[model samples]
Target: MKTKINLIFPMVVMALFLFIGHTSAQPAIITQWTFDDTIEPSTGEGTASLIGGVTQHSATMSNGWRITDFPEQYVGSGTAGAQFIVSTEGYQNIVLDFGHRSSGTMSRWAEIHYTTDGGANWQVLANNNGDLTPHDVVYPFSFDFSSVAAASDNPLFGVRIVSIFSPVAFNPEAPDSTFAANTAYHRARTPGTGGNPYSGDGNWRLLEVTFAGEAIMPGGAEKLTIVDFNGGNIPELNVPFYLTVQTQNINNEPTAIEIDTEVSISVTSGTGSLNGTLAQVIPAGEHTLSFSDLTYDVAENGVVLTVAATSGMVLEPAISEPFEVVYPLENIIAKWTFDDTTEPVIGEGVASLIGGVTQHSASIGSGWRITNFPEQYDGSGTAGAQFMVSTDGYQNIVLDFGHRSSGTMSRWAEIHYTTDGGANWQVLDNNNGNLTPHDVVYPFNFDFSSVSGTANNAGFGVRIVSVFSPVAFNPEVPDSTFAANTAYHRARTPGTGGNPYSGGGNWRLLEVTFLGEPLGILPGDANCDGIVNILDAVTIVNYIMTGNVHPFCFDNADVNSDGLIDVLDVVGTVNIILGRVRK
Candidate 1:
């Protein structure tokens, strides 16, 4: 009597939801597969199979179905999993529940991922899973697809459980592990035994795979409304912008806004790639959802976005007003990719080894290696690499480069600059402000825009040199071995039992670059001939009187700084030629 009452009570409440309300209801079973006899779903039309280069076969398990022959330890994370495909045409707030049991030798981490467009694309349910404890005979796992708008009603919806790397717990005493390709979080121990490696022969059994969701019942007509990008402002290329999508009735009232629906965005007309998460679900009781980090890579005059329903909830697709995407104002002045030789690949610059450092012909991080330094900490402020370039017509200069250091090298590097050629050099930031380069290639950036005489200078040079410890040493600190004549920061910790610091350790550079915004157009240079004279005045007059076009820049004809090309602008250009006004 007790079991009958518990099951009957929920069914009665679900029946009341059918006629009383359409927006809110309890989730009902959409599909289920016990896999008791075959690999087909028992409750709905779908198929299940093993994927990702793993051998599979059916066998008698303690309960339902089982498969053996998983990937070897630490080799194939994300390359093996079980896949299930089904249609969710009338469902919202979809949820998945499953039971898994793994052998002690199997990987302890698994991920739940899904695809909306068949198998063409897949997205992970971000940061949802953890270490799969092996001691449990049947571990139940539940994932809420309610927030993933793309997982909701589609013919090609599919879900999979893939193995991922064994996670490591965080500890402040030890440095974090270097990131590998498919890392996970939260480490787990083997069943009964403490720590064991994952093996290829381990067995994994699965059962009671079920999917449930709130069924959409039709009543009021709904429409999807897509807000324009950045409220119709011109967006910069590759810069992220926010967008909003809402579901409402034909009258578009706040009370009539539809809830719990999934909509997808598509590029109606554009040449570039539309990036970031393109689909999101409206919350349970909310009508609008925002995707805050959307971006387009190429500049286009007409980029139109359309939001449409993958589920049958919305009647028509909502179209956005066409908007322009413009290029970022900053442009690269010079770039060097030292693939085979240390030479500038773009623009003009002279790059060379400096302060007794020599170039090695072997690939380190970059193809060209700058090596053979002075004795360890001997060239504290005088040795390393130097680059001389002219920012003749550019302002707001920024320098960027990819750099790496060998284990034995000093990690501290100081940036020095000379504004009036190489006659006088000063560290860009004092000795205490040195940068620490890693063994793995990493980027370093310097902004010289605010420095005096950096812009429009024909004599600009910068250097990166090793530096000694600038701070007084204390024996209580972890780095007490560092002396005044030694590098303040060690690339590798001293007591870690790695290679010792030596002068032979080197630094490698790649993709060295200088970026700046071009200076404003020369005043009164209507022809853009790099000079302002009588010809510029004549050119301004010609444009105003006969509607003639300037050979170079029409904007230069507006010499009076007014937003028009008229006789007043021509008079302003004449005054500059006569030296009555500053050029």
Candidate 2:
């Protein structure tokens, strides 16, 4: 019967992003083929050889050395043994797809070697064959060409297929032939072959060997583009700032490519400094720098830049684009300003106001306050101002209030929140107690538990209403001291309220923490920067469909940690959008 060969397709998908520019323009193509075809004996030319009595045909080898029905076997002679060859001018990745067909054998060997100068010298590129018993072997094999040496003058390269039957051991007959003895059994030997003659039946068939060419499109030079800057300048003082950058493709297509790049900023003529590395997916369009605590004594005048590809790939000259550093005014005291016309009232130690009011300012005593409370301290209509505060789906809202007097005031504050734009509000937090003043600050905390809305419905503000005691006040206390009992709303976590004593000092409007999923209003809420648009959806889908997880997962893209992402997480994300679940 003619030799029977079965074709197996492994489950493997490979995707690579290449930066192409005019100087480094090179088209890449991935080649795949299995060496199972048979040719007549006379057809064997160059390195080709004949197998069995027939000309050229694939065969299932039972014994290690036997090439055909004759039974005469040939063992490996020296370091330069059996192999194949191919050419590489501008190649990036070389993929080998194969499957192991065995019952319960341990060791099976197959390796790919390349020679830069003809077949004279060969370097091992990859070696793969594991100890999986009853091996179904339905997985594609992939090897990155990043570690291999580049092809210079003689760009022509060839592949060598090395197959060894005998275990690696010192041979007494040919002492120099063997290196060391290996107790591990290799599947290359037949069962009946007495361990010496190399028996057992095993074969390695070349299912497919694909040489993927690199596609270096024009303008594909990998470089960093400064998109935006905070404070408008660098080398700024204790003032925090951010930087936005993008990675472009050869065709100038803004592809979300992550590059291992660095960023450093300094003054033009002055002496200020800031440095950091590019991390995670910079997205396609633009991104902002998350650096918040930078100090600059003088203004930034000059700027230096540098960049390089992670691997041996030589990036175009655009990698290092230098620009000037312009610094804005530095070091301005942050004080809370309030919109006085909004309220201007303080009832019997109680104040309440409607939500969605915008006329407000920062405060020195209170980070954010509602001005003009009812003159007298009594329970009345509306007392406080209601406003909305949202996070980029990364942080939660924490509100704190304090009564600074020795007066018994029955005080209380309630936090009403809604995922839908004020269409509904859920009571998140509430407080009630005596205001025995002596610089006492009570922190009312809300974890946004009910704020389980998508990034779309992430639009949420707070409606804060405080009530004070209706009792007599000690005349010893000054009126201005208790004139406006301060109340502040800050975005912070438990035990993380900065400068709580000063009330409004050092407080921020947004606090990005490493807890909870960034609010997902729609599919793309990967980084939870709070917009359920295309970017967010693409981030989630890419991770799920493709086995690539960029740092953007911190934005809520990694629904499950299965190493492989899928749509199941997207389903839960959809639930969050419907207000069915909170991330």
Candidate 3:
């Protein structure tokens, strides 16, 4: 029941939910009948027929549909009615509304009933016990027709009103179409002559009659979702695949009836989008259609291809969330952008939280400010700057950092390697080529690839450490003169060897990109015009798409070096342009 339902609510007009058989909107008044018809044999407002009922037709009407002979000495039972007939086929949850007043509440209650076989067998619905009397004031009454309709095999229904008033206890249908308000069985308690229906306020009056029902029609259309695809559920980037779509009636309308509705399907973040509408001659229920042929596009690992359904009808189209498709990476193992955010945005690597190493603002991306550089390295501690890199033959560790210090009190950094997890440490690399302390102070790169490992092993790890050096600024304190560390923390005034740190100065490291050996990529750089620019990337795409142009070298064109030329080259080229790769 979406409570009452969906595709149908079992949802009312105002998004209201009903506790009906199915989700649906609340029933509404479809037709009504008010006996204001001045003309006889009235074909009233709701196209209803005034059948066996007393006709008090009047050009200048007074009050309502009434019966006479009330407040008289009692006799046998009497029954009379102004029966209004209407149809209730092809719909359910029916309701009837009527109002009337009478002269006696002492009489047995009147009843409202329905007949499926033209008044043959009457199933009593509601009674008039709640109607007011004596003063003859109009009151209200309601009856739920859900059970009666559900039990019936037929749709044609009739409503009958039977009044059993007076001293008569018998309740029966009026004799064939005439007013029985004065029937011998139904007598009033009043012991005087009761002839005029208008004279006395004790007459039975049927003021109005109306019908309402929920059409049993659906309010929601079939949902749009991805189904039965040829490829495996796991997506593969840049692959051509076909998937059959189970497109049902978007209008959720009963297909038990036929109609013309249009449907369109398209995809976002996916290649080869469809553009067109289809003439879907839908059946009473659910079914499917196929997109036939489609090519999944290559995208950033987590990008999704959203297939959406759009229609120009009462149906709300479906928009699917991101769908997964990916091509596992090769060659490049990890990439980090310390843009202040924890964890790499695109890599699966280990970043140790040691010392006072914290994310700090930098000129580009994010930087790690190495604050209390452990005066010592115990496999961890202040020596830890960022992510750990396990070396395997020529594992390139490229980093961007800044070094700042003053004479005789400057801090120096070194790169060390250990195949035994820091046990047997060795001078793996150094980039302060000039041997100058804190020379390249703000954004420098340590091309660790230039120095190869001693043993071709996987356990080989590398770490960057700092040592204390003395440097004197011409002046210190608020008067300037002291230099800031690579991380940007200035040397303490008077330089008092600030706390546990030899010199309280900040050092910064921004980017650290690691890749496998043989990254002398010119890969993605097809035209080898020195740098791997967008032009080289374009060359590869041209060769693959048109073949008229070719790359200077096939090896170079294999951007990701998957040994294949496709959209991945374009992605790789883009990564290169954005400096996501340093090889």
Candidate 4:
């Protein structure tokens, strides 16, 4: 009994060691050629070629490489094929795999060959030649070269697959003359028994020629990891953010080569979808990938990003840490539709008649309509309509609206805006930075997004009024008649339109809006209640002196934006509340 037990234990231990050794060995990708994008190998180093009379070409059909101009079936056998040359340095247990299919009249049998000296000499793989039975659909084939010690770790290693004639069952020494001549052997032939003979016009298509082996060093990538974010993970809604990804091996190190793989990010947990440049191709010899200008519209919590590679890349998808997408701080400060409502729909504002221009209910549309005007081109730069809106907690103010003119109205108008409560005004210029042409038409947005001192002002206002063209005052005197496109005032007056000065025509306005982005932190509002006052100064002082744990905004406490909250900041805050300074 003791002898039998000892023998069984030794055998069991041997089997265990063999299983562990086999399972530890993983096949690393030495090279791969898909021919989907470039003629170069997809993963590592390799060059493809055609043997004998075969011609190789690239096409988008199934993203495969094609070989054409073959010899007649059963003729030139064991000669025509495709070859892939690669260096298997730092690898062992080499293997070659590919997918191939043939046209109806193409040769069916092919043999795999290898050359350890870079195609100078070749040797046929024993008993590896077989029939490729499928047509159009790919049939997979693999060859193991573990016994060929000379093929491993060789820089000049190469392999090729060639068409070969198969022996007939009755005549073992002769070629199979009827292999592809009958209907059963061709894809497009009729069901009847008789068919045409195989022709050289037929061709073969091959894809995914992969060369793999056990690596002596770190190898192919197994997973992806997000390395960094250009705009941070918790970005504002509708704001663009870029992210970087790295391809990592099983040991969590960046792979040596992550080429030809496409990487993309998808919103796996949020209602919003990713927009703009979602996927990027990993360039040759590069392991890190980057995306550009990705945005989400809706603010939501637990927004997760799933970074994925293409299916053929054989990489595990990665998940990003859950992060929240917050609402954009900027908002519409005030908007007036002038469609039965003259006040702003968003915030505090009012639209009122000014400059002797009265409102009419029924003309071009429901808006502020003006008719009466000073004689031809007289009140050009001095009269029209006015809009007042407060941008108290916002910056980067902009304006948009719609305006129309009657056929008889003046063709030119001046756009005037005030940032200091109408104390001073500046004329908005055309896109060319000129104020004379006034070429702006209806439904336009005037950008003040880059202009300074146009935001957070309680006295902000805008005025659109009549203006005379520069052509009318070429000699410093008003032209007696209106230009070709000019119109008279509300009523026809004598000597208008090629006559003396006359007042005739009308103007209509609607949908005036003021937009701005919320300030990151209101300069003097230490408590962050959307206002600057005495309490803000007191809040700053109390927090600094007593370390009081009251509600506070550190950014607001630094009133001068100098990264400090001391007596100087307190003084700046006081100046703002006392109307002695402006932010």
Which candidate has the top score in lDDT? 1
Estimate, for each residue in 74-130, the C-alpha lDDT of model 3 and write its tens digit.
322223444544565445777765554454422324567677766567676656552
Q: Could you give me the TM-score of model 1 versus the true structure?
A: 0.44
Model 1, span 428-500: residue lDDT tens: 7642432343466655678887776666666778888877657644222243466665553446643455555
Q: For residues 1-583, what per-residue lDDT tens digits would candidate 2 score against the true structure?
A: 0111222323122112222211143434333333434311111122333222212224322211112121112333112223434455434443333333332232344455667787677677755543222232322344555456554212455665443333455232211144353332344333343333222233333333444445434444355455455546543333455555445554444444443333333333334454443333332234223334444432222444333233422333222233343223111111112223222221111122442222244443443433343334443323444544333333333333332221212234455555454576666655533322322543333455334442222355555544432223222223223323333222222243232222111211111111123343333367545554456556677765664433254435544544444677676566666667655
Q: List TM-score per model, in order.
A: 0.44, 0.25, 0.28, 0.34
Residue 240 CA displacement from its true place in model 3, Å: 43
Ten-residue region with minimum lDDT total, candidate 4: 1-10
Candidate 2 Cα misplacement greater than 4 A, ranges: 1-29, 36-82, 99-107, 129-140, 151-154, 165-185, 188-197, 200-202, 218-583
lDDT against the true structure, per candidate, is: 0.66, 0.37, 0.46, 0.66
Error of 2 at 402 (Å): 99
Residue 76 of model 1: what lDDT? 68
Error of 3 at 19 (Å): 20
Error of 1 at 235 (Å): 7.2
Runs off by more than 4 Å, candidate 3? 1-26, 39-53, 57-62, 67-79, 103-108, 130-132, 150-155, 165-203, 219-583
